[model samples]
Target: MKVCLVGSSGGHLTHLYMLKPFWKEKDRFWVTFEKEDARSLLEGEKMYPCYFPTNRNIKNLIRNTFVAWKVLRKEKPDLIISSGAAVSVPFFYLGKLLGAKLIYIEVFDRIDKPTLSGKMVYPIVDKFIVQWEEEKKVYPKAVNLGSIF
Candidate 1:
């Protein structure tokens, strides 16, 4: 299966990277910030840089929406996954419309409250995974997969 892994550069990126066992053999690519950590971590992987400072930033959100359209159209991944801050929004929404399955893993740090991006994509995601059992209270349908780390 083709997968599109999308997340922010730091903790979010690390979160997704921890799932390497699951994605290692798949035809996959990444969509993340063009930052040092991301660049270093994804060394030889196929990656597409998206606009950043996405939290509450209308300009970047709009720009990322276009980027999302372009990338999703070109890649046509069968699944899209993310543990996010903000960068996942455009990609998830657009990917869903393109008929890709979506999975959103709420950051491990958040136990009770829902993140902005998590809340935005919750209704549309095919699976909502939570690292902590308590998180299930926030995202009622989230599957408690313990922690990726």
Candidate 2:
């Protein structure tokens, strides 16, 4: 199955990298904000750029929508997965619009609280997965899969 993994750099990319072994031979596409770590770790994969900000920026959101549109058209992935920090929000929406299963893995950092991106995308995702049981209280529907690591 085709998979599109989207997220910000750092812990989000770390989570997706753990799933890489299970994705052998699948048409896998990765989308993340450019970072030194992701660049070194995910070299040569079909990747896209997303601007991730510490704070919400309206201009970046508009640009991200257009970027997602182009990628969704090209990839048409069967599944879209993310360990998010806002960068994946557009791609997850694209996955839904294109009728692909969307899985949102809550960031490992938010072991106690739901992330802003997680809260925004949770209700629409096919699977809402959290690494911590405490988070399950906030998102009753989430699958407690331990740390995606």
Please, what is the TM-score per model? 0.99, 0.93
- Number of backbone collisions per candidate: 0, 0
Model 1, span 33-89: residue lDDT tens: 999999999999999999888999999999999999999999999999999979899
Per-residue accuracy of model 2 over 1-149 as CA lDDT, tens digit each: 89988887887788888886777578898888788998988898988888767338778777888888999898889999888877778888877988989998887778677788898899799999888999999899999988765
Q: All models: lDDT? A: 0.95, 0.84
TM-score for candidate 1, please give it: 0.99
Segments of candidate 2 deviating more than 4 angstroms: none
Off by over 4 Å in 1: none
TM-score for candidate 2, residues paired by index = 0.93
lDDT score for candidate 1 against the true structure: 0.95
Candidate 1's displacement at residue 96, Å, is: 0.8
